[model samples]
Target: MGRQNRSRKRRDEMNKIKKARYDAKELIRLKKTLGLLDAEGNEIMKDIADVVDIKTAKEIKRDAKTREQQELIYEHQESLEKGQKVKVTNDKTGVEHVFNSKTLKDQYGNYPAWFKKKKTAKRLRKKQHSQTKNFKQAWTTVNVPL
Candidate 1:
């Protein structure tokens, strides 16, 4: 097969794999809703235990993080409305740049270096996919080297 055809074939296979996983998760959820399986996907027996929904520590932390981010966004909006200037310090030159609300939207210098280099959704997805065993197996099937 040509290079383009091979790539396309691999992409289709990956999509199929992803769809299968999604379908499997959906099926498990359906079974749980029907009371056939527990919340953890284990078989439910009247003798064993009742199904329960509990939040893990990770979920609690994630919720807190989202709340914090929302608060920050609100603060930023309020500051902007009050015509407050954003101050950003350059790491190299140690110079502070105060940006007005109008300039903040159009200028990137007012943001920190880490914020400026923040990964996009697509890039984050690609990075995560590359780390998965499925991605490795798919690439190998295409006769491509890691």
Candidate 2:
């Protein structure tokens, strides 16, 4: 009886999570259809339909955090385009290091450290899985074929 109750509770929790996700997706869809939100989910500043309809939504205000991120991205892109060296501070070690623009990205194109690690692990796993079992003996026997 206790096991059954626990299972039922877990199922109910899962259903609630699914419903919340669905509701969020539906809200986004409705906002996009109404022109209240952009394709990237940014809100538009247009006046309400009842009030003086104005196209003030063109002026989107970005928070300071987003603005700083955009600046950083611009700097990185500019550095890459101009063949200039850039300085980067390591988050873990607090050490500043200079790197060439070409060295910033991996062979697979724009990928961060964590993503590179994940891809490396996945490749190794695939390689290990692809090896077949060997039936040959370590040492050659007299009857073994060449």
TM-scores for the candidates: 0.27, 0.30
Q: Each candidate's lDDT (Cα)?
A: 0.58, 0.56
Alpha-carbon deviation at 135 in model 1, angstroms: 64
Per-residue lDDT tens digits of candidate 1, residues 1-146?
A: 54678889899999999999999989888777768886667976653235455689999877776765555445444544655577767788997777665434314444444443345444334334444555332222123332
Alpha-carbon RMSD, each predicted model? 18.3, 19.8
Q: What is the lDDT of candidate 2?
A: 0.56
Predicted structure 2, TM vs. truth = 0.30
User: Can you tell me which runs of candidate 2 are displaced by over 4 Å?
Assistant: 1-3, 47-146
**lDDT of candidate 2 over 45-70, digit per residue (tens):** 87677533454443333344355445
User: Local error of candidate 2 at 22, Å?
Assistant: 1.4
Which portions of model 1 miss their true places by more than 4 Å?
A: 1-3, 45-146
Model 2 clashing residue pairs (backbone): none
